[model samples]
Target: MIQNNLEKYTIQLPKKLNFVLKKIDSNSNGIVFITNLENKLIGSLSDGDIRRGMMKNQVTKYVNINSKYINKKPFFLNYNSDVKKILSYLESKKNKKKYKCIPLVDNKKVIQDISTIESLRKYPIINLKIDNSEINNVIDAMKSGWISSAGSFVSQFEENFSKYLGGGYSITTTSGTTALELALKSLQIGLGDEVILPNLSFAASINSIINVGAKPVVVDVNPKTWTIDCNRILEKISSKTKAIMPVHIYGQPCEMDKIKKIAKSKNIYIVEDAAEALGATYKNAKIGLHGDCSCFSFYANKTITTGEGGMVVFKKKKYFKLANQIKNHGMSRKKFYFHETVGSNYRMTNIQAAIGISQLKKIKSLILSRRRIFQYYNKRLRKFNYINLLPENNWSTNSYWLYTILIKNLGTKKREKLIKNLLKKGIETRPAFYPFNSMNIYKKYCSGSYKFSEKIANNSISLPSTSISHYDQDLIIDILIKEINKLI
Candidate 1:
């Protein structure tokens, strides 16, 4: 119950049925606990119990602790019960349909708190770990009244982020989608141009290419890396191919050496959609350093968040300057209100940057925590023959933004049923991204059979990773194993 105030939910015995009814009405959960003079919990009452009591006693005016309607055998837990104990009780088959809230009682049977289903059963796929540092920075930004796109924190965040990636020109944007769009626009790769990328990625990747008036050339991902098949890039290339976007899916870095070699020989640009792979590396270099330009997201679910924001890192100053101009409505930097080129409002706010600055300070620790979680999941689930763990190639370090697994031989329907059953048990799971060509708008971009991409999308499930406690992880693993066992 997270140690909340329990006064509103507790009441003494010698009370009228109407009084108990009012107490239940006052509380949001529609429940009230009846206690004795020593504050010892005796029973509980709900709206349904009161209605039944009214009919049984012919609308009795008064009720006591011993009333027939008082539920003496109410489900409860010890006041000092840990999270695992609470979750286990809630997930028990006996309590599934009967109880939505449980009373926390001490050894003496004195009620201490109330735990609701919403409180005890919540297991989010991702949760932010914000501290006082982030709060103070945001408050400082607000007090300074430079809350918009103009402020010192914006530049500080850019500088810190660039330095983190081993030095590159960086510009902030409204979102990762905007960062990708700006990257494409900065390179002058638009109409009559084509960009090749893997079929398995967030919709933003393909949408960014289409938004820039470029045809997205979709290709199959490798079965092991779950990244773009560098071996297939050559056959998909043409004179119109301006760039090759290799997405680091699930924070697993693509085989950049091969992709870079191909791009060099073909004289094609490389724009990386690194939104999911920040802090990850291909070989020893960070993810954003391999391509001509790379985009990263700072959305809420990302390793580091700014509420909603993104960054673009460029390999050259020319592209950086051009992208900066396009980000702020294409206004000339030297003159006020002077329009240099057609652009959109893609600038990130100072307040968001302030939060980003605080998050960036702990980026290393955050990445380590995610990696540890991945290792734990791998160790526990490896013995099961029905699932394949996330890929961590020898040449790459996966940040493991999400602990995803592929269920062997499971079709889409059975996999969805597994997800649904887990969700019903209060454990959240995410299906892998659908192949780009599967969508109606991208059907025309289908070039060949993306069998591997489709198979991954159909069978993969991303488990909860961020800020999850060891107890929560155990609960999820237990329930997941049980449910998967049922399916097979």
Candidate 2:
């Protein structure tokens, strides 16, 4: 087996032979990497080199205390080298599996990380499903010459989305961020207002609050659902708290009932950031209806894609009207350029809406596929007891936007290495959103520690989750199983 203990596998040149042996364990198969003061990799020292140095000493152990048998020309990979290339290089070596770990170095040869062969597999993670239907719809919209911001397809997209979600007004926007901005703006959240949000969410959720001139009150997330901690929101709420932007992160619902009760009592509005959760339902109720207004993203990677678009779903016509006015540069539907209020140009194109309309038609099927993908992954991975697959409470249905797993005892460094390895094999994996407190931009605003968010961010890895062949999934699982075995 490759000795993965880096502390035992790295050293500097001219170290005392005995000391180096003790450090790397003279009998161990581990090799010590040597670096200069600038942390540039020079070479690697094997245990055999140490034994040979001892043998070369004419006076035996008393003759020389130093090692001169270093392999000055050791193999190392450039940092961020594709996993596939590294695997090809390793397969050519004698001990293919054991020699798989390679030092990833910068241009100056400074160590960045390590990649292993087991983590690199040929099976891909996710595949985008854009076939004839998407193409046909876009072409038809384009040929009609109504591909601009306003068109019949835009209304059709909004109508279809609302109908798909069990009835609510849907206001399409250029992007998810714009949709969120419109929702918050409709609620009148501006200067001196605070929006309670989970620190574990994507950057867009946080940015929208800042975009609306509202201070973001960072709250910890629930470890189980990886959603906003409803309990934590109370302590962060103040007189200035205007809204709770609960992001249904990675296709799971937050404790909506409890959060709704809290919001109702505090008289604070809720703007559900359902960017990653398009079709998820909480307690038999679709997500869009619970909040004062909910937002959905149709970014290429979401459960459904409008290529680049989002929707603000409103329960009340007033909010929808306000969002529509804001989206169209304050232009009223009746009188064009009859400026109503200071607004923005966040309108979605008819071309995009046409695609969205087509995509929304298959929303139910798409979500079912996502859930099936999760279930498939869960079934294969559950036997690996140490892995925590994405959480799904009894009351909620997951959209499984990205199938996520948390490996116990794995930290950020190892998690990244694992991801790099997956990338080598053409499998595209991503780390979970880093905690808000972990980011420097949010440092000035963050008050207290977010313990759970930190833990989840460090340990989580997201698998590629799209429509793919069962064989591909099985191959992914097989390789993943092999890699997880090494983690223990």
Using TM-score as the measure, which candidate wins? 1
Which parts of model 2 are misplaced by more than 4 Å?
Answer: 1-124
Task: Evaluate model 2: give its TM-score.
Answer: 0.75
lDDT of each: 0.87, 0.79
Q: Which ten residues in a row have the lowest lDDT in candidate 2?
A: 58-67
**Tens digit of lDDT per residue, candidate 1, span 46-157?**
8888788778874467878667887887778875576666756666654454556788777778886676766554456875678889999999999999999999999999
Clashing residue pairs in candidate 2 are 83-424, 84-424
Q: RMSD of candidate 2 to the true fold?
A: 12.4
Q: Judge candidate 1 at residue 292 and give its lDDT.
A: 98
Name the lDDT of candidate 1. 0.87
In candidate 1, how many Å is residue 85 off? 5.8
TM-score of each: 0.82, 0.75
